[model samples]
Target: MEDENDCISSDEEDQLDFLLGEEFGEDDDAELYSPPNVDTLSSQDTCSSQSSQSISDPLERHIYWKDDNTEDNGNVDLRTTPFKPTRQPGFQTTNFTRRQLQHLKTPLHFLNLFMTVEFLTTLCIATNHQANYLINTGKYSSYTDNGVWEAVTTDELLRFFGIIIYMSVVKLSALEKYWSTNVLYDHCPVNDVMTKKRFQAILCFIQVTSPGDIDKGQDCLEFK
Candidate 1:
């Protein structure tokens, strides 16, 4: 009777082990097959909340994230103020007389708009002043064959500038070549305007402002 009781106890232990193993295996299978827990909010609810948030926040509504092609359905408030022009558009010449309009037909008239007669006269006076200053200081002694330096006139200065512009367009190997009597350079009109000596004289003493006018230890343009 004792051996039969021992055998029954062993059978009960075996049945318990089998049941526990089946339960553990089922738990592992359930874990592997179960879906992930997601938020209870529906797609419509999430989209509506985002749209409302974007509408509330002005900065967020306009934020364009890189690689994000999604667009919000909320209406964007753009500045719609009508543009009232203060002045009439297009080139309409104002404050010009009929005589001035006739003068505008010449290219020199346009050039003089920037380089006015008063400005040219000032430059001519400055150039002459600088030349006389250099002569009085004995600085003009170095130039060979430079006879009594004549004062530069506004008309002569204008012609000088015209010659300079012409020279820039027609390049030459040497500066003197422009005035050369060589048949190759006979077509060049630089010498016809002014002699090379006069050009050199003007170039050497071209000054915008007198050196004496400038204060000591101050820049030329600086006000005292």
Candidate 2:
């Protein structure tokens, strides 16, 4: 009777395993990174939305492996390789440069960066203002008692958004490619790809314009 019961228990365990597998197939692997607050991130990182749209485009994706199409050890074939984007003649110019073409990244990259800075500054100012408002309004007022949870919610949202940005930067560094906010990023090591003099001028301009003082210039944007 014990032997028979052992067989029945084993059968039931197998059935449960099969049911779990069917329910979760690949989702178990995908859910490893449970975003603490994905909705909060969406509302906070507006700049990421523009960048994510470009990343979602199937046409823009590339295999990016050194041995993408060629067979290895006579075992694998083209079908076995990861998805590779067909290289166009123009694509080389885009990645590299020619007489007229310069850096692979478009001018829009700088604009997107500037806008992101503005967004962050705005967030900081709003948060500080909200804190002062709450503290000064009444005695011993707390966020929960005030019927508003904006401070905690917004704080967590920004923190995760920062993580997303850092992870993207790390991944792009690993890939040695950058794609964000309708802009591109690449560098051509080869000389004479574009005018050296023109490149020097751009480098000089960037160096000359960097802000040197922050605290000193706090009153520059005075609210009058």
Point to the candidate with the largest TM-score: 1
Tens-digit lDDT track of model 2 for 36-98: 333332342345445334433321231122334655474543542456667754334454337
The TM-scores, one per candidate, come to 0.55, 0.18
Candidate 2 segments whose C-alpha is farther than 4 A from its true place: 1-115, 139-160, 163-224
Off by over 4 Å in 1: 1-92, 142-147, 221-224
Per-prediction count of colliding residue pairs? 0, 0
lDDT of 2 at 204: 26
- lDDT values of the candidates? 0.65, 0.38
Please give the range of 10 consecutive residues that has the lowest summed lDDT in model 2. 201-210
Clash pairs, model 2 backbone? none
- Candidate 2 matches the true fold with a TM-score of 0.18
lDDT score for residue 193 of model 1: 96
